[model samples]
Target: MTPANSDGCSPDFPDEALAAELDELRQLLDGTDKPACAEEGEGLVIMRLCSGLTLQEWEGLGARRDLRDWMALPITANPFPYLTRIQQTLKELVFLSEHDPLTKLHNRGAFERILSAELIRSSRSGQPLALVLLDLDNFKTVNDTYGHPCGDRVLETMGALLAAEKRTYDYAARVGGEEFALILPGVGMVRAEGIVERLIESARTLRVVCDGVDTPLCVTLSAGIACTKGKVAIGWEKLYAMADEALYAAKAAGKDRVRCAPIADLTGTPEKTLVRADEKRFLFTGTTKG
Candidate 1:
């Protein structure tokens, strides 16, 4: 399947590449090799040939032969060039539908879908799932001061950082301008906080070399974390809202820090706790450069 670019579209296929694939398929189908017994969808039709076979012999065995018998034939070959290409094209389309072209991460729509599906699985398995929302600190200042191109460079750097940090099962996505989301299945609050701490350190160390700049540009990230264990009967929407609240708290306290939403706020209880956690709970690891 062709992977989608940031714009959410499959890359244009080159004429030369298509032609080369066609040529290779033609070579495989050339009459030198015996064609394997071919069956179309649902066994509704089959294609096979046995040279000089009597009508009676053909009728007795029917038109189809076992795959083992076809494999035993010295001249037998697989012939389905069109089918192979179609399958590949379909796969490419699926990839384009789900992936973001720019950062090569799952797009928002795909992320939401996966979040719902994962929540269902978590509910069934009684496993914890956590979500982290990240926003770049001073992103607008970078854009206004250095220009949008430089800002884009910083965002691209962030995308790479998030991609590298993602585990095999994690779902990471670019959900908005200068904002990213990470879905951590089978992970609880403490481990998720540790992950965010490492990310904060990485953000502090990240540098982008903008055009015509003697010094590299550095930016920090502010994030909020929310987990399934936060509240009973909470779904993705509540979790996300709680994460967003925590994110605002991070921004209010200071940029370049991580905050986690507690159960009271997530559940929308009358006694919602607005008190921010201590600095240690902010999950800051290194000095954040303004």
Candidate 2:
């Protein structure tokens, strides 16, 4: 008795056995949504599932052989749904790895990697790169007086502002607790200072309201900026350190201000230039691009 469905094409088997075989085939195809390729070799049909799936992933699923053998069965099923699930999972994992869970900004690790890559690109292209470090003013007071939730809201607000205000190519990240970093590719000191000045002005206008607060909480941000030409000998680490020093200077001079490191230090010799919040002009007494 040849086992066959209404098409009458297989070994003579009962309907129950045919149904079970079809179920097994369906289960195998369910593993991935990619269009599986069927190849015939030595009287056996091998089905390969998932185009982008690596050998390691097949091993992890422990269903490589099962899928191959199941696809050999005389049954047809679509695997697109399974592939969609796998792709969605991969996207979520990658996002969680590279982004901060709190602020939804790039995490410190991602920012460091981006900065290093940008440094290499800048070196090759001979374009200037600028780094800006920002610290929240009296952030501790927000946490102490309002609570951690309120503090979180404030951070979220700052993160939103950065995302909205930064240029399309700018890389902004929440690099540390109450601290953020921005990488400006192809931007020099004067232009970088202008951007930071606008950021300072924007920070003043940010107001976050939380539960149990008498009034909306407005926080201030102090920034330290450092810029170097693309061909400069300085690396990302040195650039970040200089920006951090400038940020410290800003805090010392007065919170809610923007400070800039000396252009000479970045160019050749180390120098310091403090830009006050009330400064009318971004005076650069140092070297200019030729």
Candidate 3:
């Protein structure tokens, strides 16, 4: 005889067939213990078993309970207890990939990405952009004299100062052991030079305290500032090379000073006054802007 369906025990089935089906179901349940029913919130259900199978497999084993009807149960209240930890781990990984571990600033890769985006924006808007390259003068001497610990302290201190001194829209990245690069958007060569001068002054006055004594360690920085205006094929490489040349000039002249190449050198010079408005007042011999 055909076996009777066990679904809700239909009344159409004969008594003998129903008894045989019931016996088969009992044997199946005995071999594989029935899973415990648990409610997983307002509109969900979870089946828990004392076996090796997972929740999905156990739920597929013939559970037909409406999840919304079991909302009052608390057995499956929290499904993912480690969600916060997982999120934190992901955030840490992202930060480690994009930021420098020692200075907590943008790494060289991150800096390049930002610079590229800014370059596109500046090129489209016709706004000028400035690139400044700075290197610590005689930093190795400091390391040899005061020790590596002190050198680390100096680098950290300088990095913090540079970060704090930058404008909100500016980007500064530590590119090497004693080198840094700053990208200034919407700034021209003249303004960039002024900024570099201020940076040099600030570095000169920065004091590093070591060994519980007020050790007045004076560190000098040489910087080259280059500004670009029109559409240029060379792009960042052009600016970088110009700044590198200017930096070489600064080092050759004397360390601890700011050097800037005229925009005319990078792009064709405009017929405007080279001197600033304020500078014109103090100058004894120079053409003034009309």
Best lDDT among the predictions, by candidate number: 2
Error of 2 at 236 (Å): 1.4
lDDT of 1 at 132: 95
In every candidate, how many clashes are there?
5, 12, 0
Across 223-286, the per-residue lDDT of candidate 2 in tens digits comes to: 9998887655566788898899999999999899999997623456322244443342334533
TM-score of each: 0.63, 0.66, 0.62
The segments of candidate 2 whose C-alpha lies over 4 angstroms from its true place after superposition are 1-77, 264-290
lDDT of each: 0.71, 0.76, 0.68
Cα RMSD (Å) per model? 17.5, 13.3, 18.0
Candidate 3 lDDT over residue span 67-107, tens digit each = 21111111333435334433544687798888877777788
Sort the candidates on TM-score, descending order.
2, 1, 3
* TM-score winner: 2
C-alpha lDDT of residue 83 in model 2: 52
Question: Residue-wise lDDT of candidate 1 within 1-290, one digit each (tens)?
Answer: 11223332223444344335434545666644443433332322222323333223322332232111111111233435434544654676688789887777888999888888887787666678899999999889989998988888888889999999989889899888889999999888899999998999999998799997779988799999988753334567877888899999999998899999875234554222343344334556443332
Ten contiguous residues minimizing lDDT sum, candidate 2 = 66-75
Instruction: Give the C-alpha miss distance for residue 9 in model 2, angstroms.
Output: 31
Model 3 vs. true fold: TM: 0.62
TM-score: model 2 vs. ground truth: 0.66
